[model samples]
Target chain A: MPTEGHTGRKIIYDEDGKPCRSCNTLLDFKFATGRITSRAALPERAGRESRTIPAQELIPGSKSYAKVEPPDVVELGNSSWNLLHSITATYPSKPSEQKKAEMKQFLTIFSHIYPCSWCARDFEKFIEQNAPKVDSREDLGRWMCEAHNAVNEKLGKEKFDCNFWAKRWKDGWDEN
Target chain B: MPTEGHTGRKIIYDEDGKPCRSCNTLLDFKFATGRITSRAALPERAGRESRTIPAQELIPGSKSYAKVEPPDVVELGNSSWNLLHSITATYPSKPSEQKKAEMKQFLTIFSHIYPCSWCARDFEKFIEQNAPKVDSREDLGRWMCEAHNAVNEKLGKEKFDCNFWAKRWKDGWDEN
Candidate 1:
């Protein structure tokens, strides 16, 4: 699971040298020229080297499909944060012990199965270090905010006002 | 939890008249005034109705805050579908039985905790009828495609060509 922002490249070779289920693409894995670093081997000059390429590459006759695409980090971060915040916002206020256990297990499994390799690793490390707070809604919500802030910090983005979780996820802004 | 498109109205209330943690926004189970048919009672002339008043109402100066926000179904659906598709696209081809079991359990729990009440119910029903096929990567991926297609049909969207799971998710196009 190569993470985003890594300069090193990884290969996904199949024993039969066949197309893999990695996003259903037939990645040659090794460059046609014999190395993972060759630019000429790519069907699209992917902006990122994550294992699964974006689906737009599969579209026919789309000349600039690769150029306009957002980098993997941006898309992954946006999608991940949106889902995670929603989950936290919906956490029970005073969850039962079983509920708490289920949530913890969910996070652990989520980290393992998450799509991006490096992002998943980072999440697992964060969970190990901070642990999830599932006993109450408030605790889980705050922990989620903190977890997101940590990612933001890594990406050099400004911290969100955690108090505004309700506004950000549950309520529309004042103008709305 | 109200689903999308019921009289086009959504409901977010619990039987006990307490917020049921469907995404954690505090939905007043009933309106200040009665008559479930009063669209005029809505703060924002909501396109659909579900209980959670948007947090804008809680802001310091929002005298009319509760009048405007619709329930969170649309956003949740968009976000959730994006992530789940991604997850299935990247599933391992030869998953172990334990891995399969975990995935099934995860979906069961996910349905229960999902924010919208009616949407969750629909999902549970879908699972009960179809059941997940996590025995192999292909089975699970196909199941995911069908599950998503079910939602798409409800929303009146065109059915995606399920054959393109690899192309849509794992691989870029043939040119890639």
Candidate 2:
């Protein structure tokens, strides 16, 4: 079946002497009704030829052929993932570097208060895991809550006052 | 109460000479505890004066404070209310340039599909109304689905197809 003009001919091609590819009919005459009116059957000799062609073996000039290059692989110490992941696992991406550094500085300011070794370790691990997810500086409130809770749980301390976390993060604890 | 330390000596200043800002009690020795500690109460005169300082104002300076800058005003032009509304809205101070570019590109592509007509007006309106709340590129798919569905309904066309949207995007039809 012919499928040349699915949505009515809208003058896609200029009217000179171009033949329609599907119908193989001359499209030189302008129709008074402004509609496609001609249709043609395949020529006898043209109908005998095999149309199937393997895609890979087809002409290099064909649109379907594309030269794909293999992706680059980077080795990270023992295992290989990608350079970005390695960097992030170690430190953080450039965008989050500031926040990471702030957390480190905040840790430094409050270092004296966190006397219990276990509490400190747990707090660091908790912050490292959660800080990158913080979208805004205000999100530090949530981080402090989680860190305080984690530390208190680790040290077997009764729910440490939330004020300790909030005050330390806020005041930088009398940097004198 | 006597806020001072041993020997009736003002415990405010201990042998090591480190005074606790909170209680004004002299610290005996310093240790790198690596965690926040609670300060003991200080003498009335000093403690009352210091407590008045706001915690938010005392946070140590970080890159967030240094880097945060006001956003430039964006002007909306002839487009869907969604696109216009998104353009006119304020974004976070630190929105990544890539994100803004992607938004601009999406709007550009959308403009081509809706073109300069009322047909795309609803999509523009919808996007503008919703863009501020969108946090990531993945969220855009949902917005597009809803916006396109609304536009299609308004135009009396078939339901918007994601495949068709992708094809139109790939073909660069809406880019113009």
Candidate 3:
């Protein structure tokens, strides 16, 4: 059975017939996929009502629950955002032409090879709609912030103020 | 004034003559750089003994301490690793030639555009020494684990067992 991701794309399956982990959230791929039909598969949640376990916690499994747990889509997405924002935060304020070209190239390749197929496709479309402005740190920072806000909006999360991209990613706020 | 990063590279300065945030940890760039000379600059730490504050906590500045804080080298590096490892975890078990080439291109671009100059240089050198092995998921995962272990070893951190790359990055432990 195939699962449809948030993007409405049918998640691809591995040789084992498990849905691709990178294309779907752990919830859709793990619990909702009917793979854990046996109560024995979820020892921690066996005796407890499913509602008691936070969805996020249930997916990653607490450290005590698993010795080593692979990151789900959410975990991967958040960390990737951290890295991307940090990159823009430190971008040269006045980049050389070569630097600008390289930055654009980097983004293009990043969008192509991002682990999350659906997420990457969405981002590629986003880039097509709003081409990266890599002329300066400010341009890049605002562009990335806007990009993040788009995701946030799609996820029904609160959007960050684009005005404070620098304060959030580069300099500490004055109040500190 | 310029400060030296853990990599021993002289942290570059911006037009304002402040040390580069990406090249140095927040400790070296923020407190140790002498830029925060006045007591007012450290509103939270001013009244207390510096020893009471954890160094990592001090660099990130608690949300209560600062409205928004940029990531230092440590924060950026950790997040970047999370993204990198996740990429390898989801990489195809038997990839196409195009996938292999694209992955290599992504790594090269990532090395060039990584926010931390010193860290990027080190990674570039590492890549040259050990070219990426992207033929299969197993090969790529082990290669990435070894690469991360190299950095971990340099930082005096415990090394991960490369044999368990799938357990750590893709499949949740069976014990879970």
Candidate 4:
């Protein structure tokens, strides 16, 4: 039987009956499926760096693959946010009708097909509640910042102040 | 007058007549606009870490924002590739018709509004030449790898072997 995820939604499983890798944190999936050999072997957290198996353990000719661990939920989220924030940072202050429509459509499709089922559902709900503000760069940046803060809060991370979204994502911090 | 970009596409400018940050590399934009007073001040490359202004230069109470530099073309590309590969890594081996359609739409829209105008155009052309294969996880992963390798070749970077795409993105390298 598939396990109930913390989100109260039933966690999805693959055709092989394995818990969906993208939909659950690595440790939670391992524990729920009884893959962990012992409690002591549990990682401190599901961080990419912490879990990366050394390249020496890999097959020959794979030395170049060092530190290239498959992403867990946290790592994937971090990379996705980096791309999302950067995209908005460079968005035109005054976008054309086509640009605005494309951005809106991109976000909608992204929310629907994101690999993490539960996380995607949460984001879809968030978008429904706070529609994307794509009229201008500033509006979109602030909206993205707020959206990120919502995720941060859910993940128990620090919330970034939306006022500095532009500085953080665009125009580098002032030097001198 | 706005400068011609390397891709032969006219570089876009914002309403302020400034070169679009997302359309050209930071150093290229700076140089074309004569924002760089001296060639010696030019960065080795448009890397996020290479050009991050120290937190000490930022406003007070912003020390926590260290290392959060505005992304340049290279940085944005790196993050975007990470997200794209990870998404494909977690894709279902056998997807529903709805899932396949959604994935295709997501990639098409992504290719349209990918922030970097020239890069987006190149990706759009690549997609036109090689339609996204969404029939299975393996198909999608290979397609994404080839797409990334196309960009890598264009940028003079080493190509990743597609044979190990699964090991690099889906399963961890074997340990012991």
DockQ of each: 0.06, 0.01, 0.18, 0.16
**Ten-residue region with minimum lDDT total, candidate 4 chain B:** B20-29
Which digits, one per residue and each the tens of the lDDT, describe model 4 over residues A48-160? 33465566755456433453556545456766887798788667789999889888888887887665556778899999999999999999999999999999888666678
RMSD of each: 24.2, 30.2, 23.3, 23.8
The TM-score that candidate 1 achieves is 0.59
TM-score of chain B of each: 0.58, 0.28, 0.61, 0.65
DockQ of model 4 vs. true complex: 0.16
- The residue-level lDDT of candidate 4 at A154 comes to 81
Each candidate: what lDDT?
0.58, 0.33, 0.67, 0.69
Q: What is the lDDT of residue A12 in candidate 2?
A: 26
Q: Model 3: runs farther than 4 Å from truth?
A: A1-66, B1-66
Per TM-score, the best of the predicted structures is 4
Error of 2 at A1 (Å): 33
Model 4 clash count equals 0
Q: B8-52, model 2: which lDDT tens digit per residue?
A: 333232233433222222221111111212234325425643454
Chain B, candidate 4: TM? Answer: 0.65
Query: 1 or 4: which has the higher lDDT?
Result: 4
Taking the tens digit of each residue's C-alpha lDDT, what string does model 1 give over A1-176? 23211223233322344311121112332332133444455444354434453665433443222322211333445566666776776667878888898889888888877765567788999999999988887788788888988987876665666676665654435342
- Model 3 C-alpha lDDT versus the unseen true structure: 0.67
Ranking by DockQ: 3, 4, 1, 2
